[model samples]
Target: MPRWGMVIDLEKCTGCQACTAACQMENCRLPGEMWQDVLFYSEGEYPSGKLTWLPRPCMHCENPSCVAVCPTGAAYKAENGAVLIDWERCIGCKYCMIACPYGVRFYAEEKQKTQPDIRDVFPAKGDKVWDPPYKMPEQVQDPKHGVGVQPKNVVSKCTFCYHRTSKAPTGLKDLDPNDPATRKFTPACVVTCAPGARYFGDLDNPESNVRKLIAEKRGTRLLDQTGNRPQVYYLAGEAPVIPETRSVRKPKQSPET
Candidate 1:
């Protein structure tokens, strides 16, 4: 079996959220739940300040902590190396969310970070959380692989577009979206990347583009210290860095004079 992997060239990335939009449409994700994200933040003082954008998707770790923590065996690492959550078995525990270093998982039961909930704006016709204004494309509807319109109260994340990738020709090494022949089986986010920054291929194959890029470009993983062994790799002159840890908390107030 081929070990799936992705390589993102930071130099070619323009921080466009095209991948984000395509993922939402392709996967039938909720308005605020982004499977592909471009995280933008500023660095340095006024004169030297600049914005840095990091595109993030599920790392699909070789040793996924999410899989370790799921109470119902919902989160699993597939044979091809994609980490996926089964909507049917998920208990909405959010343990996987807590375990992920990339903050890529979403539990839709919680209120969207953005205000004026879009679910209310466009209500679903049936048991789905909400129906989108646009017609959702037909999907394989395999809840075991989380491939379809999500049900209520389930945690979800990126699946590397499994529904499409699974259908690619057997023994194929790479799934380059730019190739017309392979386009039909390519992931939506990979296909929609405007700058052609993302690449997907069989990491175990020496001839595969992903493996070649990782060798030539000096690919690096985020939070490598955690030992998740992420299959996703980044390439650039200065590889994008993610802090090993983080938390949100209010600052302490000084005692009143």
Candidate 2:
């Protein structure tokens, strides 16, 4: 069985929010329902300060707390090591949301609002006042791989782009970051990253880039004290230091003669 994992090189991340925007569009998510986010923070003194841009996604932990706390069996681990939720089984209990250490899950009620200019941009057709000019992508209709057009009242988070991941070849357990097959089956966030800082593959495969990077870079996980054993790893602490330069003050002019 394949154990899917991710490695993010923080040293290369520029805090651009490109991954975040790509995720939203790929999933057709509402305005504030971000499955991927870039957390921005600063370190050191002024002029010499370093800005940290951390990209966060679902960890898909080896031992997921969300799966254990779910009152219903809605939350479960997939064969590919993805922590997933079945909307049909979810009962809006919020237990999984509370149990998640990364704060990635959100209530579907949060995405219930209609887009700002529905009436202006998508005028209704004759006789059909409710019909909009545009509709959601066809891929979202498959419940086996998607949450569907409306994921109302349920808790939702990243699925590692299952619609694409599940398309990997029959014999392969997981995708390889270097393989063309893998490139065709990767998540939107991974492929859209401008800095090439994100990698995804099977951790169980010794030759996979994800495993290699974690070993070579000494990747670290978030909140390791919880022992959730997050599959997502971060490569940090090696960013180049920037020098600071202070402006020189001129001496006061002598009194006019």
Candidate 3:
């Protein structure tokens, strides 16, 4: 089995939120509920300040903290090395949410439904209808994946688009467009990304493009200090720095002493 992982290049990302939107539509997530998000940070003084943007997703740690603290064992590593939530087994304890340093896990408060006002599922001018077989009224239901028809009090997060991955035909397990091995490979986010910042593949394979990017760019994992061994890595940007200066002021004198 290959160790599946994703590499997001911040240098290449424009903070367009394309990846974020794609993930939501593909997973049919509720409004205001996001499986992936882009974080913005600033450094330095006003004139020379630099802005940095980072795209965050479920780290899918090799030694996932979410899995360790889950009382119900609902969060576990999948066969393809993706961290997944077992909705049926999940008790909505929020332990995984607390344990995850990346803050990727979320609990669904209200059942998520497709908005009636929205005409298209994606902004690319396509039909907004639900894919067949997984379709349901308001909320989708899948007995095999134990998703879509989630209970009111269950935790949910990124599954690496497992619903699509499981059905991926053989010889298309990876995401290499040029290679025949990934001929049928497609992930909702990866497919919808207009900038092509997100790259997914078998991290265990040194020959993989993702691995090559890691090697050449020296990509760094987020919050590596936590020892979570996150599979997601980031490529940062170089922005100008600004300095802060302080001035001394005279003390106030007593009036009408």
Give per-candidate clash totals.
Answer: 1, 0, 2
- Please report the candidate that would top TM-score against the real structure: 1
Q: Best by lDDT, which number?
A: 1
List runs of model 2 lying over 4 Å from the truth: 111-136, 144-146, 170-179, 237-257
Clashing pairs for model 1 are 124-131
List residue ranges in candidate 3 displaced over 4 A. 110-149, 169-173, 177-184, 237-257
lDDT of 2 by residue, 1-257 (tens): 66788888887878788899888777656567789987654555556655545788988998999999998888899898888888778778999889998889987554236567433354444422123323445555444433434344677788888777767765464464456867768888988888888888888888877888989988888877777899998888566321111112322331211
Poorest 10 consecutive residues by lDDT, candidate 1: 248-257
- Residue 130 CA displacement from its true place in model 2, Å: 12
Q: By lDDT, is 1 or 3 better?
A: 1
lDDT of 1 by residue, 30-143 (tens): 877899888765555556555667788889999999899999999999988899989889999899999887788988887787767888888776767777765446557677
Q: Write the per-residue lDDT of candidate 3 for residues 126-229, one digit (tens) a residue.
A: 21222323333443344234345345567888877776565555443358544455534556677666777878877888877788888887767876878888
Report how far residue 215 has shifted in candidate 3, in Å.
Answer: 1.2
- Alpha carbon deviation, residue 205, candidate 3 (Å): 1.2
Q: Which rank order by lDDT, best down to worst?
A: 1, 2, 3
